[model samples]
Structure formats: C-alpha cells, structure tokens
Target: MEPPVNTIKLSQTAKDQLLKLRRHTKIDQWNILCRWGFCRSLAEASIPSPVPIPADSNVELTWKVFGGEMSDILILALKQRCHNDKLGTDKETLAHQFRLHLHRGIGYLAGDPNIKKIEDLIAIATKK
Candidate 1:
C-alpha cells in the first residue's frame, strides 16, 4: 500500500523533544523513536487535536525510513484508527491525522517523568 505521505517532517519542538528522548534512551535513530511515539499516540483513547504543526525543523524522513520494516502494518494501523474515529481514510485525512498523532505521541513520551531510560519505554509497552 502507498503511504499517506512520502516524507515526514517534524516540527522544531518535536525535534528538540526527540533529542531529549535520544539522550534519555541512548537511542540514536530518529525513526525508531518516532515509531514508538506514533504507536504511543495510537494507543491513546482520545484523538489528537487537529492543530497546525509547522514543519520548521530540518529533521525529515521518508515514510519508508519512518516505518521501517513495518511500513505496511503502520499504514494499516493509521487507516484503522481513522476508521475507528469515524474519519475518512482518504489521503488527506490520513496524512493529517498521522501528523497529529505523531506529534502528540512524541509530546506524551517526552513529558513522561517515568521515561528516563530505554527500559522505561519498554515498561510502557509491557504494562498491562
């Protein structure tokens, strides 16, 4: 399946947050951290607010790089989320929601006081 967007551009704030996350987790890859953030947002019960997010940062990645080996599955998850939210699954809607969710999730992860290390991140995923 084609991705919602060919390229993902993060806001400058998001880039800074990811940098903090990198320092805390010792993870060097932006894509890996972004994947975690995207999934984290998806797990939330509430939909992300459709606020404007400026792509003011130099941090960018292709969809392939962002989703890595799970590109297809990630796209499916985004589509499913849109469906679940009673939103259209058209390209525009998918792209919009993807950005919202990605940013929201990154904020969520970065703000969590518990997330001081990679194990903390794992704990979030493992918790019942």
Candidate 2:
C-alpha cells in the first residue's frame, strides 16, 4: 500500500517565500517542496517532516519550513552566480540558483551517485 500523502506544512513567512519562488520560477510548490525534502535529507542527513498546520486543530495541513541544508545550497549557488556576475539581479540570480538546486535535488531524490559530484558537472557545463 502506498503511504499517505503528508500535507506539506509551511509557516506564513516560508509559505510566502515558497509562493514567491514558485511565481517567479513557474515551478509548482508541491514539486519544489518534494525537491527540498530530498536535498535536505541527502545533503544534511536529516529527515524533514512537516509540523502541524495552524488553521484548525484537527487539520494537519501546512508544514513549517525549517532545516537549513537546502537553503544553504541555494545561498551558495547564488553567491557563486553573483560573484561572477552571471546574473544581473538578485531575482534572476535566485531563479537560476533554484534551477541548479533542482538539478542536484532531482539527482539526490533519484539516488544517483552523480548527485554527490554535481559541482564538477556544473563546472564543466558552465565552462565557456
């Protein structure tokens, strides 16, 4: 039997951030959350679980978005991109940054050994 689909929980702030990312990148929130969970588990060796959503006592819908590993990866990617002026603004840089994480994140979710070596591939891919 398939496991129950856990409702993703997000704090109002995190939810807003997630929605903003989704709006700018045109990526679905659900997909991004799944990717975030993968990146968190693989990069940080911690299992991420959603906290009880706040709307009602009985409904456990929203999850608090903590666990900094994925965010750390994102920050690094943005730093690297911006250090070289690869993207002109923080908005564009962040979008591309999320794309990079998505690539690595998918690899992690799929159990690909290549996930562990993404930086090398990225280096080659980005080389002129």
Candidate 3:
C-alpha cells in the first residue's frame, strides 16, 4: 500500500521535543520515537487540532523508515482512525491527520514528566 505521505518532515518544535525525548529515553533513532509518538496520539480519544505545523526542521524520514516492518499495519490503523473520526480517507486528509497526530503525540510525550527512561515508555504502553 502507498503511504499517506512519502516523506515525513518534522517541525522545528518537533525536532526539539524529540531531542529532549532522546536525551531522556536514550532512543537514538528519530523514526522509532516518531512511531511511538504517532501511536500515542492515536490512542487518544479526541482528534488532534488542525493547526499549521511548519516543516522547518532538518529531520525527515521516509514512510518506510518511519514505519519499519509495520508500515502496512500503521497505514491501516491511520485509515481506520480517520474513518472513526468521520474523516474521509483521501491522501490529503490522511497526510494532514498524520502530521497532526505525530506532532501532538511528540508534544505529549515530551511534556510528560514521568518519561525519564526507556522503561518509562514501556510503563506507559503497559498502563491501563
């Protein structure tokens, strides 16, 4: 399946947040942290606000790089989430929503005071 976006360009703010997350969690790959952020936003009940996020950072990841082996599943999840939100699954909509969720999740993760290590990330995943 084709990804919603070929290249995911992060905002300057997102780059900063990811840098902070890297320092705390010791996760070196941007793609891995971005995947976590995307899924984290997906887990939320509300839709991310459609704010403009400038692609001002140097960080860029191909869809394949970002999703790794789970590219198809991630696309499916994104499509399903769009459907659940009553948003059409067009390329534009998917791309827009993807950015929104990714940025929001990064912000959420970076802002959380409890995320001090990789174990904290696991703890979040295991939490009910």
Model 1 pairs whose backbones collide: none
lDDT by residue (1-128, candidate 2, tens digit) is 11112243333444444444444345564444445533433353222222332322221232222213444554454455445544453555444433344334433433433333335334433556
Where model 3 places Cα greater than 4 Å from the true spot, the runs are none
Write down the TM-score of every candidate.
0.99, 0.29, 0.99
lDDT, candidate 2, equals: 0.39
lDDT of 1 by residue, 67-95 (tens): 98999999999999999999999999999
Clashes of 2: 3
lDDT of each: 0.98, 0.39, 0.97
Report the C-alpha lDDT of model 3 over 14-98, residue by residue, as the tens digit.
Answer: 9999999999999999999999999999999999999999999999999999999999999999999999999999999999999
Model 1 spans with C-alpha error above 4 angstroms:
none
Weakest lDDT window of 10 consecutive positions for candidate 1: 43-52
Q: Give the candidate order by descending TM-score.
A: 1, 3, 2
**Candidate 1 root-mean-square deviation in Å:** 0.4
Q: Which has the higher lDDT value, candidate number 1 or candidate number 3?
A: 1
**Cα lDDT for residue 121, candidate 3:** 93
Q: What is candidate 1's local distance difference test score?
A: 0.98
RMSD (Å) per prediction? 0.4, 15.3, 0.5
How far out, in Å, is residue 89 in model 2? 43
Identify the candidate with maximal lDDT. Answer: 1
